[model samples]
Target: MDLNRVVIVGASLAGLRAAETLRNEGFDGEVVVVGAEPHRPYDRPPLSKKLLAGEWEPDRIHLRQPDTFDDLDVEWRFGVAGAGLDPSAGILHLTNGTDITYDGCIIATGAACRRLPEQSRYSHVHEVRTLDDAMRLRAEIADGGRHVVVIGAGFIGLEVAATARQLGNDVTVLEGAPAPLIRGLGEEMGAAIGAMHEARGVTLRCGVQVDRLHDDGVLLAGEDGAEGELIEADIVVVGIGVVPATAWLGDSGLQLRDGVVCDETLNALDVDGSVVPGVYAAGDVLRWPNPLFAEEMRVEHWTNAAEQGAAAAKNLLAAAGRGAGAPEAYAPVPFFWSDQFDIRIQFLGRASADDAVEVVLGSTQPNEDGTVKFLALYRTGDRVHGALGVNAPRWVMKMRGQLMEQASWHDALAHAATLA
Candidate 1:
């Protein structure tokens, strides 16, 4: 196997980490990282929290500095995207009419924020995903105590609301669902987040549909009937969710079902088997098979991208016989955290599909400083599949190890008793 010419698409968390991991794993090959964004790879997690709160600037979120890429000897190709792929020729077709041949290829193309309906001025509607988006959002919100209408009650929306509130502005969250994060966290757990927002002086309006965005405010129509109420907000932030960035690979022969489909090894599932021999995928774009749940899953967390990128790098090296041993499979516990209005909400594992649940730690007010809540321990008969913790970072971080090691629920319960 020749260790030469590895091309990576999307200079995101996954793409940057993949490049770094390749160099770290002793891959002295020709590495090229292509990004659609003009700027280098940056941390997106803080965009909604610290950056919006005016605590951190846009440039501060950059993960790797200018000199770092040069030090890594990476051929940085910014402001260009991989338009097409010729698998037989082993060439990546760039949008700007540039072609690059590669021995191995990595598709770390991440997701993009789903846009809202068309408006007169698109600048009024904001979505946080990149440094530019965050900067623009922060600038609008910094105009001193202006009302902000946030659509969706997900982590991003809630975080933006928290930031707006911290800046002495009135914030209202309009969630189409009955409760916030009902799909992600079950009704019971999501209600806890809603309760936290209510206690923090943020108005939570559930089961309300946005008719349309007007000059004054959003028209509402739902169980409460149609009301053309003017909430009076300077800007509207929509955090409904994101769609995987894989439309460019439409001609690449890789299976795309809501996202790029991949095997447990992260190899792209090609139609002809030899379509993209050495091509692989990672991060939110790759709907890879998970061993723990025995199902193909797609994770859209920040950590997932970084970790999977490293794993994909190792797998690529293994395919080239440069790795020390067989690369382990990518199976994250699907945990993520959010900091909003002095509340740090954290989850250990996937709480999306839990049927039954129990409050293991704190029932209502678990901790004196803040609310510590842990939800339904996942189990198959008697064995625990995973554990989820809400508003408990230390607990979630601690349980992550247990989830990875397949620690028993009985022991977890025994340990929960000690925390009480």
Candidate 2:
């Protein structure tokens, strides 16, 4: 089979890695990468942790060196947004009124941060999804003595709060849930995190609803639905979460529910045929079936993007063979970590399913360094769907490997205990 031109949308972690992998796989074709953002792909995790604390510089957040792409002969089209796709015509329409033809394509467009309500003044409001967002928020915190109000208790929100606290700024976290990370870590772990934050000087207000936002403060409604109370803040940072960036593919005929639907081989369902297939999707913009998870889920994590991007690239090369021998599959254990108040909180597996969980490791302490927290969530059978660790990278890493190996919950717990 002859090599074909590949166009990748969204120069994200997944897109970049995919392009590099194609070149490494000896695909000598015209590779073009288009990015909506002005800056190249950077490490987003550092944006909330180190960037907020002024530790890592924004310019240095790039995933690759400046000359890496040039060496790989990859053409980059920065600041250009992919408007839509015409699979029948084998063309990609751009926002700038230009159409580019591609033998294959990969859509790695990731998610963006959700904006606050319209009534709230966005001038003083901040977000940390991008480098610019992090820089703006970091400057405000570096200026000294600014009351930072985090409007969520997710990983990003908590990390920003922890960074703000470290920068000598008063931090207050407003979580709409009953406890911090309740939806993700269950009630027990969420309560443990809340207690840890409170012990570390963070004003965590859980189970409260924000009624409205004012110039001076936020009007919050208590759990009892009484009169709202005003909580004054200087700079408000919102980290509620994000949605997939697939607005442009509305009329593209691609099966998009939460993201671009794909098969196990990561092939875009729309352009199933065609020698020069014009469309494929990956990263946060992809909602593909996972043989490991036993369900179709959309993931916005960094590793997911990178792994899926590479998979899509390889599949594009093997399109003629009908995606045969594609080694890259979306079977990740689904892991994510956050650094807050000197405590490194790491999660392995999905924490959304577990109801009654048991703590088999480290005590619930915020400052617990190098400690592991093995949470066993058992409903019927002995199944450990999730595991949380504080400053315990090795434990989480081990659990992730076990999950990948399809280890049983009973065996995993017994093995984890031996390590403990």
TM-scores vs. true structure, each candidate: 0.92, 0.91
Q: Model 1, range 36-66, lDDT digits (tens) per residue?
A: 9999998989988888788888678889778
Query: Candidate 1: where is the Cα deviation over 4 Å?
Result: 119-121, 222-232, 272-275, 366-385, 405-408
Candidate 2 ranges beyond 4 A from true positions: 1-3, 222-227, 271-278, 321-328, 365-380
The positional error of residue 397 in candidate 2, measured at the CA in angstroms, is: 1.8
Among these predicted structures, which one has the highest lDDT? 1
Question: lDDT at 265 for candidate 1?
Answer: 78
Error of 2 at 31 (Å): 0.7
Considering only N, C-alpha and C atoms within 3 Å, which residue pairs clash in candidate 1? none
Candidate 2, TM-score vs. the true structure?
Answer: 0.91
Best by TM-score: 1
